[model samples]
Target chain A: MTASIIEDRGEGSPRNGEADGFPTATPLPVRTSEKGEEENPSSILLGTSAEDHHIARMAALALGLSVLEAAIPSPLPGVKPGLANIVTLIVLARYGWRTAAWVTLLRVLAGSLLMGSFLTPGFFLSLSGALCSLAVLAASQHLPSRWFGPVTHSIFGAFAHIAGQLLLVYFWLIPHTGLAYLVPIFAAAALLFGTVNGLVAAHYLDKNPINHKIQRHREMRPDCL
Target chain B: MLSIAHIKPGDWLTLLLGALLTAFLGVTLWQGGAADKAIIRSGGKIFSVVPLSRNQLISVPGPLGISQIAIHNLQARIASDPSPRQYCVRQGWLKQAGEVAVCLPNQVSVELSGKQKNYDSLNY
Candidate 1:
């Protein structure tokens, strides 16, 4: 049906081409005039992919929830799953850092627009953290081949990534004079939240949950399928 | 029964040494100039900085909400509609290098830069 519509609109593969040579398969080019603004499954599929990108970003926002921030009481502020970091990490690990960086940038742009404001500073702060996370993920991949546990690796990386955000907080956010007091609070919170996310990521890494959750999508594409 | 068999002494050492070094660095950064991060909590809400010390807190009639600010040497262009008392006004003064004053209610935030610079460039 979708192929037929695409063909009808002159946007699909071509007129002479048959998607599959089967008796019931309509030659995707059969354009009938009555199908005005009728829902095209092919276009809807493309629209769905854009929606998936939006969903991924919403997931990023969900992970960022904490304290009075997300309606759940987290003892820390600025705490997030760093899942988006993990998303960027896996993308870098499998593809390469540059592509993962682009993914991160796209996710931020999409996430911010879906969130409805590029003018706000929070989005930029998140963009900063994502950039730093990408940097850590890229550099850490080349480290010496050591007998590794995924949990420990995650802990180390997660902590480093959180620290990346801290660097921005310390060097850029706080006034020149206010560093003495802020450190204690942020440290206390980082330790608390970092351990939680580290353990969660570690557990997921151990179980390879990322494969189950996200890996299924890429396979759904026709080329992969 | 302890098993040294599971431990790659080098990897453990690296992880340990790296975490310690990072912690030390974090603590150092925290201790370096961290004293100025004053989180002002008013009526059970947190505000980054509100410059006016005397009027640290205020209540807004109806749903527009309340706000606070910390004033140091920072100039702010606030969207006055969000009752400033909401999440935006509580982020008081953005006078520090990397400190961000967030007004979530207004979807506004004032970010402090390392050096005081022209925000007009940011307009573009």
Candidate 2:
């Protein structure tokens, strides 16, 4: 796991959105996945105790947010690289699929609580997106990695995320009149923006070679190949 | 500037699929513009939120054509509508849904309810 170094905000005043009554959702630190699950080693060692669980819960908060910050719109306001997703991909690439899936659930819960959008349809929408990405990662097993470059991986995963959102909204719960249309608009948004994120991520990976620290057997594998 | 050489086939497929989905949605929403009487019981404040006549309803014109908004408060009534506003009158009346049409101090907010309409639900 990459050692996370967060800038500490003192006990003085609350963070930007914290003063609005709702406590800012604290995130958990990154941890290794065992049995393809988001297991914070600290909490596991401390036992299934409630306080440890709370600490584990806070770990995914900021990292999940970072994934979201990635997807950028071409026009800027809408353009962003799905950065937080890199975390998702990384989790999957290292720990396998289930751990990434669990991480996504945690991210959804944390993001909703932090954004004060808990239980809203929008929260569910985000969950669907994460699930969609998971689906892509799962399905990618059939294809050659050479076909899925960092950019393509991000793009396909983003498409899956958005498609999952549309599927959830249009099929299961509240059937609004024309929500079916939001799929394509958002999918377009995902693809158009997703490509840029993928490219940037690709560039980043190229620039930052892996150190001898993390023992990754798949390091020999090309992400695109 | 980024090159398209890096884009994958799946990328194009997703974009095409997304566009097709949008086209279908636009048509459905446009065709089914009218919603039936939905009575929501919220907070004990009676709300009459549905449309009186398909034609009498005040709809804001956009790319989607018209949006039906119902009024809520007495304050909203005092305010002047650029046109004769008639969302106040409707078929079924109830208030528990937390939807109210307010024509208040220089403002108009026709609370739209996300009920009964077949909006999409999360499946998998």
Candidate 3:
């Protein structure tokens, strides 16, 4: 049992026959006869916890919002209202910054992949924006909660998002002083969208019925996530 | 459905800060810096770098013929080009830094360079 516990399984080994942290008395029966002689028996299956499920669900919600946003005709490129941020703000207020970061990054990666912009300049820009915003939120969330709320964090996150993208554009893509001229427009958009998203997040945080379930779950598992 | 009552004091502070930042960027970046010199390229090679202070006309020999460029009032423009399209001549004035006028047929291009760069990229 100790040897099996210490042994490193193949990278793609299936988890069906093994218990998580607990050794099984007998191996699960292999029903390979019905399937015939399999050419490839390797399989990959990860043991996901409840928190993973929550993050995956929230990430799917954010992706849905992103898809809706992509359909809207924006006046300027790289200047959208960032509707998906509402979910990040809600998650931050409920689950904390780590969970919020997970949701935001997953949204960016999955959203870009869905849009077929993976590994492109657009994907990098979105990645930088998400990272910068998450950093800002992580810091700003530490402020006294009495005065500050999701709205404040949202605005700061939005500004950081645009700042990150613009710097990337100036340094990597354009490398021109001319790009500075677009800063004002981008800043204005960030301010407007940040406030709007923050308000929406605040409203959702206050009114959503899901908060009760989340609160109950948090109380049950105080430190898992 | 949220209202003004839902806004917190910190939210107001953030709004004030974001607005001030946007205004500051608008004031500073909207206007490009004054150009310092004009760079003339003829047939893919640099013909000369002329100061905008000196009001003069430079005749650059290109593939087709001579192209004349004038600099005056801290601005430069293509006065005449042997190119049939006259696109460079029609460009009128290059007042800001990084502004460029090119005559493809004559293989002549004039650009303004200074401490700051002008907006040139439009990504769709």
**What CAPRI grade goes to candidate 1?**
incorrect
Q: How close is candidate 1 to the true structure, as a TM-score?
A: 0.42
Off by over 4 Å in 2: A1-83, A172-174, A216-225, B1-124
Alpha carbon lDDT at B88, candidate 3: 90
Ranking by lDDT: 3, 2, 1
Best by DockQ: 3
Question: How much lDDT does candidate 3 score?
Answer: 0.81
DockQ by candidate, in order: 0.07, 0.11, 0.51
List ranges where model 3 is wrong by over 4 Å: A1-45, A209-213, A216-225, B35-114, B117-124
Top TM-score: which candidate number? Answer: 3
**Residue A52 of model 1, lDDT score:** 29
lDDT of 3 by residue, B1-124 (tens): 6787768898898899999999999998887678899999987899899999999999998878999999989999999988888989998999988889999999999999987556566553
List the candidate numbers ranked by DockQ, top first: 3, 2, 1
Estimate, for each residue in B47-83, the C-alpha lDDT of model 1 and write its tens digit: 3544422333332222344433333333332333355
Arranged by TM-score with the best first, the candidates are 3, 2, 1
Q: What TM-score do all the candidates reach, one by one? A: 0.42, 0.46, 0.67
Ranked by lDDT, the better of candidates 2 and 3 is 3
Q: What is the interface RMSD of each candidate, in Å?
A: 7.5, 5.1, 1.4
After TM-score superposition, what is the CA distance of residue A96 in candidate 2 from its true location, in Å? Answer: 3.5
Give the winner by lDDT. Answer: 3
